[model samples]
Target: MPSNDSLARASGNVKWWKNANIFQIWPASYKDSNGDGIGDIQGIISTLDYIKALGVNTIWISPMYDSPQIDMGYDISDYESVYPPYGTLDDMDQLIKGCHDRGMKLLLDLVINHTSDQHKWFQESRSSKTNPKRDWYIWRPAKYDADGNRQPPNNWMSCFSECAWTWDEHTQEYYLHLFCVEQPDLNWTNEECRREIYRSAMEFWLEKGVDGFRVDTVNMYSKPMDFPDAPIVDPLSKYQPAGTLYCNGPEMHKYLREMAAILARYDAMTVGELPLTPNTKDVLDYVSLKDPQLSMVFQFDLVDIGRGPVDMMKLTGYKLSALKAIINKWQTFIEGNDGWTTVFSENHDQGRSVSRFASDAPEHATNSAKLLAMLNTTLTGTMFIYQGQEIGMTNVPKDWPIEEYLDVGSINYMKLIKEKLEATGASEEEKAKAVHEALLNINAVGRDNARTPVQWDSSPHAGFTTGKPWMRVNDNYKKINAAAQINDPDSVLSFWKRMIGLRTKHSSLFTFGSFHLLEPENEQTFSYVKKSAEGDEKALVVLNFTDQAQEFKLPTEDGANWSLLQGTQPVEDPTSAPLKAYEGRVFVNFGARD
Candidate 1:
């Protein structure tokens, strides 16, 4: 629960953001009000009521800026302007105000590690060695190894695969980009670049009343002078090792401190995306509770936990012990510390939580929604809701053609899976599995799955647009959409509302309370308890991971009067209570069933 002191930071009774459960919106797929087939700010405004009804208090939008679209909107050309594909600057202003009017905060996507080649600085730097902006980008002569032939600066590889350094004919050297060839990483070594970026673009959003930022690739600011080579892992990981040197350099904290100092000046809420750092242990030092350098950090451990060889139908059954261990690893890191964790199973980059955790079948999807929500909502961390997640979106169809595919990571994995399938000695069934693996790699948790337009109604393009949508809407829009659920008491949206309301009413016990793991031995279920500073213990989170009903044995001291809070089924006595497969049980010490 929020303390009287932290809650006191409110401005004139502004105690809103503290209990806010945020949702992430990828603009391209939300809704297109102008009928141009692209979801715009106007379309989002039209759906505000739908979102507000989901018990959401904060919205985090992905990048929607002036861009070359080389890597989507991440390769930004202009910093402060809204892209025409989305809307005008006025549209964004109204969107922010619309959110605030409904008691919600909007956070912008801050992608600063690299800029589009069209950025003025990159343009000037590429012009010539004598250009004023030459130092703004890292440029160096090609190095020759004992093997012979000019190589990229160090053995550094790009995060997007291949070499991180791109040879520029004009400069007669290489420029670095941790992603695509068109996005050259900025040289943070230059003080001018840092100040101008923060003063102009970074600080501009906050000044515009934007609540906070989801800092994209913020930790890849400083790189080692000697970019070293990484030991090869996958046979297909031909990518260079830019991370060996570019990620988490010695000055990482210094730069983050500088950013924290600058953003602190404006009191902005900043969360970082650390691709290289998945475990909470990796970022524990700066992001603890007492001294949070970042408001929270997105650790992709659970998101990437299913990864390995892509066997389509094969499940990496996380025996309950391992799952508890993973959760315990994170819980203990935050045990005596102040840094909090951000919880979410699905996001723009990953497959839907329902499809990934539970079965993708509709029945399973429904259970996963309630089950996962019960688990994460009670953990000692901040909860984030991805758009359409509350309604229980599933992964893309396996039959989606190659043409429908997007996302570089999926593409890399698909190519590898296909090559393995083509190995001549494989049997027909084996070949089919290989192909299935390719589809899984492409659709398992691929971006395109989440990029599908939000299912708003049964109308054309799922009522996302009157015009042709930029991306195709799911065919199941008729059966699943916001329109049908908005007023339906039994709709998934309605259940989500209840879930959030329960959390809000019990914020003190859920938000700041320390987490304690229970029943670590059971593979089919997870149980945990949380207690706050005042010893106001009311939070008890339990989840069922399997399809069959399972018994939960709670620790002795925690055996208190309990009542069901949220679940597909109801909670009975844990000792004899058998929860249906994938069903969840959230309970409070209400002196009912125990």
Candidate 2:
């Protein structure tokens, strides 16, 4: 179904990753082959064919390492082994082979920013001040008052716990943990520690035929040499949280260069989760081909658009046009520098895109999901589709009991907010109302929304497991499951297939084209033009971000001789037509007909 011209243009793409889209999977929720109630590597191996059929040539699997599950699998206890619930090292080897057999690359989550307290390195480091591994993690002597009451070495706070410094009575010192107290921060300043961390963990995977890594907290590896006190930004905050001083630290680039050199030893690709990447300059410096520090980096500014701190109830009132402007800046910046960026709407750590950014109305959810797919794919980057995204997955039920939620961050946030409200001396009735509002907001933005088991079919447990599922499946699975949509030509699943086909047939147009936003003032519509770098081909992509009928008029200079290339709604005319709610289309420009 691909046009010959589009295929011809696509064949010009140079980098394999530039032309290939990626599929992201959260293993615990993907599928369970064994009766263990947890999705494992074997479950992923079983779905490799389905993923390949989706037209994606890469898979970014979230962490499956040995862990305490305190932070899911991010709190790694053994970098060289798999979590018992997930599978064994042999299962991982089979997964690598499965991906390779399908001509797809596999990227494991590399979470080296911290390790669980159960890790051997941390255990030995905490054993004694004279231990050889004592300096493997950040440890400092505790400060004491004249009365002999000990205080934390610094004012820094943990991202999950209220306090960052956890005391180790045996050593009589405190260790730093940017996240949970169980996951202590590694001392990247230690040369021996860095070598062991990389050689033992990373090299082990690469030698086993693993492709690369989706480096977690990639920019937070370095900390400022001087552990200075953070300026108090919130008077009522329980503890001072200072990530700005350490995130993207002075030595981060140097570390990245070293890491990149090591990665270059294998045939692989690296995309980093740069949580603190500030601007265009940082992006260019990290991913520019001239320096070649990384394949790409994930920028999170768009995901936090409307949410307040820690998924609070406060809303930012962000508009669609504002999102267009922000994306345009990054796209233009990357395209100009010969660097690359990634395009995605939802991942393991965030809520579903359809429910948060687009309409989740029963009447319009499918179309909105399709619109988001069109917007993300037509942009100039390698696209990543999360599981269930191809089938229009909705958020969990808003009234889900707090006890059913499993994300530690969300649980901690709930407790933090409830405590804050009670501290205000408000009446119980007022406090209850405030707490209810916060819970609703959490239901909207919580990570649990994306962590629910994949809705494979309408069978019990949504066909994810014959045994009990780790989490509850969405009640709408009966109507929205993959079994119901895969056969329907008009379903979200079919639309995603069509989108990926267009991407492959016109890879050059997406990989090297210059992106320009059209009608940046349009509040309800997102429209853009992508012209091939050599000016031989050009296309227009228009998407209705809202669930309401709308019309769009291209600039007169664009000319009216356009032909429809792909569309979510039936095309009546190429240049002018009434678009249904959440409708979108990609059109190719023909020279002006005099």
Model 2 steric clash total: 0
Local accuracy of candidate 1 as per-residue lDDT tens digits, 1-594: 434433332212322344568899998888887878887888888878778877778899999888887776889998988889899889888998999899888989998888999998899999999998999888889888798988776655565545678899987999988788889988888989888788767788887788888889867888876666665654444453445456677877777777877777776777788766655665875575345457777776677665643232234545667767777776557654445567777788877777777776766766677777777667655688888887777777778876677666566546655565665568889888777766756676677788888888888788888988777677677887877887877667777888778777777566555567877897777778765534544556777788777766543464576555566564456435677788766666642221
**Residue-level lDDT tens digits of model 2 in 1-594:** 333333333454346667668899999999999967899999999989888888889998999999999988999999998999899998998899999988999988888999999999999999899998999999988888799989887787677637888888888888989999899999999999999988977888889987888888888888886688777766667577677777888888888888888888896778898875668897888888779788888888777778765433345568888788888987777643457778888999888899988888899899889999888878877788899998999899887888878998788878887777778788889888987877787788888999999999999988999998888888888888988888899999999998888877776666556688988988988888887655666788888887777876545674555678888877667467767898898887644222
Instruction: Highest TM-score: give the candidate number.
Output: 2
**For each candidate, what is the lDDT?**
0.73, 0.83
As a TM-score, model 2 comes out at 0.95
lDDT of 2 at 167: 89
lDDT score at residue 12, model 2, on the 0-100 scale: 45
| lDDT, model 2 | 0.83
Off by over 4 Å in 2: 1-13, 145-148, 309-314, 553-556, 590-594
Clashes of each: 18, 0
Worst lDDT 10-window in candidate 1: 6-15
lDDT score, residue 296, model 1? Answer: 72
